[model samples]
Target: MGGGGGDGRSKELERLWAERDELDARIRLLESELETSSAAPASPAGEDAAAAGVGDGGCVGGGGACQARPGLAHADSLPADMIYRYSRHLLLPDFGVEGQRKLSRSSILVVGAGGLGSPVALYLAACGVGVLGIVDGDDVELNNLHRQIIHQEAYIGRSKVKSAADTCRAINSSIKVVEHHHTLKPNNALEVVRKYDIVVDATDNLPTRYMISDCCVLLNKPLISGAALGLEGQLTVYHHNGSPCYRCLFPNPPPVAACQRCSDSGVLGVVPGVIGCLQALEAIKVASDVGEPLSGRMLLFDALSARIRIVKIRGSSPACTICAENSVFTQEDFQKFDYETFTQSPMSDKTAPSLKLLPESARITCTEYKGLIDKGEPHVLLDVRPAHHFQIVSLSRSLNIPLSDLEEKLPMLETSMKETLDASAASDKQPSLYVVCRRGNDSQSAVQLLREKGFHSAKDIVGGLQSWAHDVDPDFPAY
Candidate 1:
């Protein structure tokens, strides 16, 4: 019966894979159609010249000869389809035809298609932004689906840039959706950012945030930045209208330990959704030259308390290396800036770093531990992950002692060891002490602490529970 159940699950997985492949093929076909349509004959040379104000640093369109507002430069009159599609927006007094026209002329580059970028791209596409560029090098994964709403279950294992661009095109196929299926580094950031009127810093890491902000400042583009983690979110518009850049506020990077990501801290899906929507709001406001944007002010959101607050942040600093008048931080310097080294943290958080605090003798592989378990050896499996994580998933009979409380619970650990040794009728012999965590890093630290406390036999599982799931038991949940 168990074998039959496994076979059924395998077949279901195969079917899902086939469906995902079909969906991918359809998306590619749609993208090709869009490209072909875009390549069709351009407007008359006179019209092209009049609308040539895009990307050349003039207004969105309104070449010197054109009299229409920057928004209306696309055409003397709105198209019939555009009128019906954006009727609600055109009805607004503040953002009527003029606002819609500006939006239609503006271009925005969203630098991450994850949680924040998902909503920003979706709303911008729906609002008829003339050109939207998505930048991401990661492939979709099951874990990203919770907060990264732009990606579907079928998009898993596909490029995030392609998935997000496809969704945006689906929402508004009239607009131009540019897919930059690569991570933005210092070398390519300037070239990618210069083409857009505004840049959105939807990226999650510090290095990328600083990199994007610096790029915007160098290229004279406004930046809409948003971040969310653990039921909290923040939004700010940097480098706009004499506002301070990110470096003006944070001259020094925060400690690596303090920079928690959604993966580590766990974000409520709606938190980023709220912040990303606000980011879209700010981008629209700035793009249309309408209501005030959140420049030099930070919006803080606390989902747990259901509170939203906007606070004034510092103005641009004279000493700001990149944005100040007297500063010499040029495009050349920006191209060569080593953001990871400056921030002392990696630019991407795709994987946790492996820790090697102990010698080979002090760590055991999951496979070796499985051997001991199969032989019915009397041993204690100590899970050093937090209590909540242990509750989520843990090996049977493993004791939970969070790494934070391990030192305080030394006596408890001693008692548990004593009990295990007595049960094995080997009280005189040292009890085997094996430590584990979600990953191997914390377990290594826990083992180091135990050894210092004279628990000489303490050893950590090399890759912790992740390796156990990968090697010893594929059925175990990794997260």
Candidate 2:
């Protein structure tokens, strides 16, 4: 009886080994079939649109064709383990296990590491996203710390992208972080965006924002965009299949006079943080395929009053140059388009003059003005700030001329000059006029206005009195 039992056990072991070998052979055969099938001929357009239908609407990779099987919906239904793992998401009818898995598998790319990028990167990383990519070419500075919170005090001189990446990784090790230590431009935008499923626009400048929108629309990828000025912030999801793109709304950037930049108008520290987090939420919604995303609507937030407003965006414009021909996707089409010319602000010469206008030639900073003053250079310094600011802080030998009162006050300067001329009985010398304001932006406009009125030797303080007070005399009071 013992001999018979031993023989039966040996036979059972042989059968199990035989079955394992057969399974290994089958796997190898399936891999070979996938390789051959993926190498099949491509369609004329270079994009494998035919391959788009594979794998139950999920992206298919390699040679094995994704076969649609019946009961796939049931297969995607919540399992015991999945339900337990994603219990929090399962509580919401809109976000079940399937939606959670979709989010877990999606990748997103965020451009810039400044104000808008900070909240977008932090929230996305903390939300269990599978992968996150950051692109930035700037270094952290003492001034940037006011709004850019991702970088710590120790990382003041470090690269912004690297510092941001470190913060994201520290939040979630499961998230794959890719850092690009360069600016995102036309030459590299498409290539960089192609690797990710979604793009988030956190860049401040107009050129980079336009480039990101165009690339996303062309590639048929979704983009979550946000921008802030003063206390107001704007948020939108652009380039989704059914939604209008960034160009569809604006068509072109606003005229220079109407355009407001952070440099010109100061932004509240928490304003961007509020707006950027909304952008991150929009991105997560797109990834999860759950709830109503901000695809066709713009959300505006006023931090000071705590108000939220929504603006609905209609379909794409028939005259849109970027989305009209779907011209943004292919490298050839993007190459043919002139981005530099496209992003250039409309010529301000054609528009009516405001309080002051900045000419195209001046590039002076406030630091330069202080040096000139210290050297006892024979130049006239004009304070273009409001009377309150001037009364609070004024440099020695500087004349108070508010930008708003410039036209009315010009005659007074001329009258004073005439008196000086009569007393001295000498010819009038062209006194070099240097303009300054709270920040350097308005001073440039003041200088340009002076030039238009025949003050040819006018100059602008680069960073205004703020830089002057910080660099020249720390004891001076700052407004």
Candidate 3:
């Protein structure tokens, strides 16, 4: 028994000795990465030497140290804390200390602080991009929390730029964060984009995308653009390495009806997260000169099917209006460009446009509808929302007929209206018809179609069920 106990103790001592050796090796590696080489200049005492001049485009390389800017005196090697913090990155064969140095010297401007901007800003800031600029004019809303992970519940009513900048700073105080609390527009696009090494197109509208890409082309800056809608997303790099600019591919904008916003057609929250991460990756690769960028290629992600495909896109066009070799699209021209007119879409697509297809007399207010309900008026309420949305919520005694299938279902709708009017025993009075949807926009079209089909009494409920939930019943579900 004594021999067995001695054997166990011997094994325990051996294990402890092995652990000590491993720890010693790790410590030595950490020290080697943190040490200032003899050829590099010594850093001043009691200073954050590693992060100096990073905000002013101070690059590093050639001699295993962060190179000083033209006039600034900076550190020779990474600080001990930073060496430990980025140890994983430092250990990478492809992206070693040199890559981190280059990344820390680059500045990036993210155009929107929404879903895509959330992850893009967060990763760039965490990865130690030197100067991170966030430009947005929007305030955080309750609905944005699902996909905009950078914002907190408490920041619901605050400016998105301020909220995102604060979060990025909280994640990495070593980097500099700039907040531009205004939307990018033709007047300021050139000025705002001129300072950054790379531009990220995280905005959600075609007008803004065109304006930004044009500005990038004018400024000779690389553009990493990403978009996510519904359960799908697409990403591409514009204006980099002979890649086509946005205008090169899309010479003409799509029809206004084809431009759908997430506010109209719902989007899966995580869809933007996947695309945003790739955008950040591409930006890092471009900044660090590490990997091949997504230039001249498009990445399509289908979230529902869990698939990602990269296809070759076209190169820069010689006859392209803005990016061709003989092109003369100057900054002055960009300043005078009418993006809204060209795209036929608003720069901010937060809500669907309210159509005035019917006169005021043909539209009934939600309060009037509530009065009709209270007085037991004889009217047929037709819900024209999509079938899936109709299943989400509907008022009692309302018939469901999606606007897409309205022409096919008109006969059924007429029968229901006839039954409602006949049941009221009003032989002389015309049948009362009301149409509703999630928003008031689609109901107007339904009313227009019904009126053309001889149902002149079909009046739209102004502001649709959304206004009904707000003005009629506070307990009704808004979504």
Candidate 4:
């Protein structure tokens, strides 16, 4: 019986050895597979960053203290406080612990701290995004309070980034907030944009919008964009897997005359607030992979009618400079386009056919013009600004004939100037016909038009009313 037992044990040992040999072969195969994979061509850096656990979409590096982690990884690693804090997110069936985990790893960069940036920063921080970066170069001004609610009167004259970051921290202290207190210029935009998983285009500047779009397309990141003016606003996303970029929507920026800044065209406070909060919703959806993003859809909001409309936007354009194969906007191509110059107000574009072309005799500084106004000089100050602006502020003795209506309303100007002309004949001159507008540009344009109409004495007020408020009268109200 003892000898039989020994034989049985020996047979068992042999069987075990056979299994061990088979396991070793499997291990060798896996090692070979891993080696092959390691040797294969790597994916794009942005893709690699995301794959490495950066986030649903996040940049893993800008060469500082950032270590790229899989945003979706380590679902079991949540701290007790984290679990408690994110219990609301965890309660959702579609977005529970997994979604919370993704948000904890996600990073976002918001490119403005004004009206749109306010709600975006606030909501993203409250949602517990892992990292938040705010880029702005403006100071908190009195005018910002109406719609830029994140900034307070206490923060007036403070840097917008600092003020915004303070508000974000007050709402949620667990997240990291980075203050990029300078403007997002063309040169630094790509570098800054590549370091975040998602970018929020809260900027109103056209060049900055294109800059953000180009960088996101190049980096393979997502963009949540928003804009509001008057009673209307638009919200959309771009460069998220398959979608049209801004250039696909607008290949070229509108001419300066067609452009309307928030300052130039008054915006309803709720209009921007609505668009900004929607921007936050899109960003969170992107970060947590929760809902359908606005990649191929644009949300148009009409505050006047209180209606929201979602419309389909066309897909990528083959001719698109940034989103197409062999696209025109390469890393090198960005350098060729002058975003700095493009974003400046039309007054600064420098394409102005010499002020000299309008003639030195056809222009007067605000001081010289102020002197004529004070001396009761019989001159007709033709305020060629639009009717709306004329209503905002106007000289006591000026006529409002908008530039678009200037040619048609020549009779109105002639009738008004007849008295000045008759009085000037007694003094051997006519009340100098002076053209004025918000800035000096439209006034200059008006002066040229007048000259073409045989009213050669028409001269543009240098710097227009803005210069008037700045140089001539300290108390003259200016927008």
Q: Is candidate 3 or candidate 4 better by lDDT?
A: 3
Winner on lDDT between 2 and 3 is 3
Q: What lDDT would each prediction earn against the true structure? A: 0.84, 0.71, 0.84, 0.79
Candidate 1 similarity to native, TM-score: 0.85
**lDDT tens string, model 3, 1-479?**
78999999999999999999666545544433444242255343102223332422232221112222222323556545457667899899999888887787788999999999999999999887777899999999998999999999999899999999999978876677889999999998887887788999998898999999899998889999999999999999999988999999999999988887777788899999999999999999999899899999999999989999999999998889999989998888889999999988888855436778889999999999999999888989999999989998999999999999998889999899778877886756766899999879899999999888888899999999889999999999987
Best-first order by TM-score: 1, 3, 4, 2
Q: Mind giving the per-residue lDDT tens digits that candidate 2 earns over 266-334?
A: 688889889888888899899888778887888989887899999888977777877776443466777
Candidate 2 structure, TM-score to reference? 0.69
Weakest 10 consecutive residues of candidate 1 by summed lDDT: 57-66
TM-score of each: 0.85, 0.69, 0.84, 0.80
Clashing pairs in 4: 53-69, 53-70, 53-71, 57-197, 58-197, 59-196, 59-197
Per-residue accuracy of model 4 over 147-260 as CA lDDT, tens digit each: 999999999999999999999988876567889988887678877887788999998867778788888888888999999988999999998858899988888777766767
> Residue 259 in model 2: shift from native, Å?
2.6
Clash count for each candidate, listed in order shown: 2, 7, 0, 7
Candidate 4 lDDT score relative to the true structure = 0.79
